[model samples]
Target: MTDRAKGWLVDLRPDERWDDEACCGDLPAEETRMADRLCDSASAATYIRARSVIRRGLAGLLGEPPAEIRLASEVGGRPVLPDHPDWYVSWSRSKSLLLLAARYGEPVGVDLEVIRPISPAAGVLRTVYPRTAELGAVDQSETFFTAWTLLEAAVKATGRGLARGARDVWLYRPSGESRCALGGIRNAGEVPWSGRTEQFAVPGSSTRVMTAVVTKGFTDPIHVDAWQLPDRPPSPVTAAAPRRLLRKEVSA
Candidate 1:
């Protein structure tokens, strides 16, 4: 399938974030309640900004004003453009970064995470991959987050969410430059979603974010914009194999 994917990385910091009075007005009623239920103030903020961006961005690409777009979530809370069933939309946030992804004619899921050591990693490792021994033998934090993001993107692409796809999906990368493949439930069948992991820097900060996108039948080099700012023009996209998660690369 010829899937066209475009992604934008928006900063969620108070000074650099992209929500305005109009954005607030365009937010659906369910969105406000979802924000009200968020315990973390920061998360509540991210949720508002992310939802607003998704609506606005999708509207831009669809040639309509934000209010005209009817964004809805499927059974697993994965957002979709119900009016245009051919379009797929997804977003993810971590700390102060938000990624908004939209693709035409294919299912898509995107996720972002600020990479660091996980304190409760051991317990989580056993919980997600209980049936596997090889996953436990590798670097727990590294492998876990790698697989974790893949699982998230995969589920989102399939509209399955973690409740249905978590334990079934596993990560495997044969080489540093090789494409990462996701395995199915108990490694039995081919999972519908395929994943790509990218590491990018926040323009002025030292913080690096790990981002992943999964699309149904997507091929090499899906268009990814790691540093698209609200005021600045988008940087050029270079779809290359992902670098190892170490903090050495300076460019996307």
Candidate 2:
């Protein structure tokens, strides 16, 4: 098996050419569905930036532009590339950032969350994060967000969203480079999802942000590049910026 088959995680920055502003415009129908679910401007902007990068990156891999691509939503509402079936793709973003990950022909899902400090009401921790309690009892506030991202990635990979239930998927803190398979998600029960983490330093400062990806095994040493979006602060990307989620024959 080639390295590409093994899958990979890439880190992209603003200096990269793929982050063109012209890429942003109207949201595809599928994305509008996702956008409607979000309530925050930061969330909306992040989604837009991520969508643009994913589309452009995939197009570049296919040697084409975003306009030439076509995407269809599965019954579950996840986006897929009409030209490619074997491949899986996902993107995510946060304040001043974006992330994308893809596997040649594998199911892929990615998520990024800014670790902001938060203190919730009593019983809230147990109701929302049951697994956190099993992690040997530590500071919930510090570990809450990290664990949250892992769950988000797993559910996104499953493509059922909250409808399948977030509690069905679980993750443990990383003890080694090898990631663990948590709970049953959609078709794959306790599927061993491979993943990687990225920490980016904000421009002109030392502030750092984190993002992560969960995907099927791939043989490729995932190629990572960057694009300077005209609107958002410089962020990172994996694969060519995605246009319409999953695509079969990516050009450029």
Candidate 3:
């Protein structure tokens, strides 16, 4: 499936148990070391599985074996290819879903989230964001997820982790456009990102899971090409109706 982007390739898979023997061998020593550092066995396993999926997905694009794809990280931890500097990758997880996105020549960051009702105390982060403030208390989950995804994609694209980015990044609508976008990144480093955030949906579950991405090189009409992956039944993610889209503008 695709949206307005020329194409940001994404794979949405369940963060479930995997064949450790089969996939784990494909991961690098770096990932193994990172996994060893984690105290929670479940969290460590998830990290390993996420990396393995990333390796296979990225290796397909590079026409190499998954085990041969060497990975590195930026100063703030977004994964990258040392040999292929032009390629970029980022991922996010929401409940059972894992979102993996890859882009060539342009830096990209992505986020996925499960929609859930918000409470006042749980929404303290919402108060910092001007966009979420526009949403009513009774009906803000969808819009809140959209706003948060935009904020995260911007920070991830900028190579700054949320610890720092959350304090600085501001979600904004570019004047006349109805869709929310990312702005207010001061330390974007060497890459000058357009900071335009785009949202997509995975239809299933009691509610719905949403994903968004942003390309860091300041491009227009950013687009997404996504796959639901295996292990789940896919359904329609209609963006043509605003009322159905959290009154959010769908960028086709």
Candidate 4:
């Protein structure tokens, strides 16, 4: 079966009043405690928003109540559905933007980074991505962020994260495709990533936002969509109610 992945981008600007009760009331106890430990309201808000997006997105995909979807982190801080091991998910946030990617049948990872000038680009390139440095002089900010997101998405997909060393993964453009159209990652000391990847700009942002997704067994083209929160929150699910089972088939 061909694996399928879906992604959603959420904006975290303070313009909208975040419905804390509806968005975060269903979070697991551990997540609630972690949110409480955030140093400031902004950080807490961002965390809540990210979790809310994940729940809502997953709920829609699984046809279940958002409040009933529970997410837990594995050993390396990778999010997983304890009840559904077949599903894979990954998330990343940059400043006021958050990205969430999920797939069925195969693992997937996503990353987003705001493009900005990197003052000491050489140090970062030399330490984490010496191969990227050899690409020759280019837009320092764009090059660094592009390579950074690619490596992050690859590692996240593999579930090893940066602990495996960013330098260990190499990102390359496949022949006969736009730089953003197709990319691949090869891990030096681990199993290679033989999945599809797509990178694009986020919509409606003044600052350039770059995002990437790495998926296994997904050969189809990827589609990026903007996710808008519902104006009226759905009724919260009660503990007495039974949770719905994830559907075996997912629509493209």
Candidate 5:
């Protein structure tokens, strides 16, 4: 939760058409094949852009060339740097936004979702809503997304993903504040680990995008750096650089 974490938020809206060659030229061969298989141009472009952002961001953090950052996946399909096992990362993409979070040795998970009307379906309510039993009194849409993203972030942090079930994770909001915390993570009806959860709204956007980050264990105040991409390049992150430039701390 402390200022120890770093992240980047990139705009995924296509401002200019990038052909397959332009988009996949610098990607790894596997990624290029995956991109090539996508029939939708926008989806392919978004995939390429997200992978590029991850490479560049990790490269900046590791002080290496983007192409040289080798990435692998954990058991649950979470991406990891095989050489730097201590470095934890998570990625999420909404309609036109991609988010990345990284921290050394600490598990981190981030999720972004564009807010829209929630169907009053029983299945959705059961899967997304916390078991607090007070949901009937609040704004259903806001509460639904708040709970949804928090559970997602927490589950992702655990690396078990939805396989662990969102209902097993609870997000607790201390009345009358924008802040919240991971109440507990229950596996097989037993609490295992606690976490810190923070939510933010992307600035200057017409559509409402709700994002949340869950860091395992308790920590200091969480600082989120929301970067609008293609417009803002990744800040040069070097050990010798000024701390401010390394990770521009922003209040989200």
Candidate 6:
């Protein structure tokens, strides 16, 4: 199905297992090799887990075991979807939670932060967040992280490494906890289109949370499913933001 027809926004549980073979079965050796090559063990594991979750979700919808999807990339390091060429796939993870957004050719991006607090990353923030100067003074960790994730998500959406010039990109924050739309940088490409950002409490975990940014051309319907171990208290921070989208149609 095309992304514009409205599909799913899957929120995978860090602890539950699905019956789909595409997810639970053994992955090809090359896939495992790529994970092994990741810079950090924790990040690699998170990546593997997110891929599994996406495979399982896709299997259920396609009514067949998903095919082997490899993580190939261009010289610039952007992940290529050779198997699912028609779909745009973007995922992000923080701590135990994993977020996924799939849509049409329009680049899609998703990001989550373990809501607690982190010491500002020195001058890095100022370097990447030129718009922060216009944001006035703000000392809250959430404020900093919110802006940080937005820019990060935008870069991820562009498939450009965060170093390409994050400071040039800007996000318009209309309110402290309200949704902000992605826009262009003063001397950079605006990355074309719209997006939404929302926060959710970590289910059954008192010490964490998440925020997601899904960019323009995601005309697909939005669905968010939260999972938790049995008998755990429900997390009350689930939220979603979807916008009407029109994507450029390219010939096959």
TM for every model, in the order presented, reads: 0.72, 0.63, 0.64, 0.75, 0.74, 0.68
Query: Which stretches in model 2 have alpha-carbon errors above 4 Å?
Result: 1-21, 24-50, 121-129, 138-142, 174-191, 205-207, 221-252
Q: What is the lDDT, from 0 to 100, of the residue 156 in candidate 6?
A: 70
What is candidate 4's TM-score against the reference? 0.75
Which ranges of candidate 3 are over 4 A from the true structure? 1-20, 30-45, 121-123, 126-139, 167-170, 173-179, 183-204, 217-252
How does model 6 fare in lDDT?
0.51
Q: Give the TM-score ranking, best first.
A: 4, 5, 1, 6, 3, 2
Candidate 6 is scored at a TM of 0.68
Better of 2 and 4 by lDDT: 4
Compared with the true structure, what per-residue lDDT tens digits does model 6 show for residues 8-113?
Answer: 3333433345322223232444554565566654455455556566654444433334334444665655555676666566666665566665565566666677
- Pairs clashing within candidate 6: 6-220, 6-221, 168-185
lDDT of 3: 0.58
Better of 1 and 3 by lDDT: 1
User: Ten residues in a row with the worst lDDT in model 2?
Assistant: 243-252
TM-score of 2: 0.63
Considering every candidate listed, which one attains the maximal TM-score?
4
- Order of the predicted models by lDDT, top scorer first: 1, 4, 5, 3, 2, 6
Tell me the whole-model lDDT of each prediction, alpha carbons only. Answer: 0.63, 0.52, 0.58, 0.63, 0.62, 0.51
What is candidate 3's CA lDDT for residue 35? Answer: 65
Estimate the Cα RMSD of every predicted model relative to the unseen true structure: 10.2, 9.3, 12.1, 8.3, 8.9, 12.3
TM-score of 5: 0.74
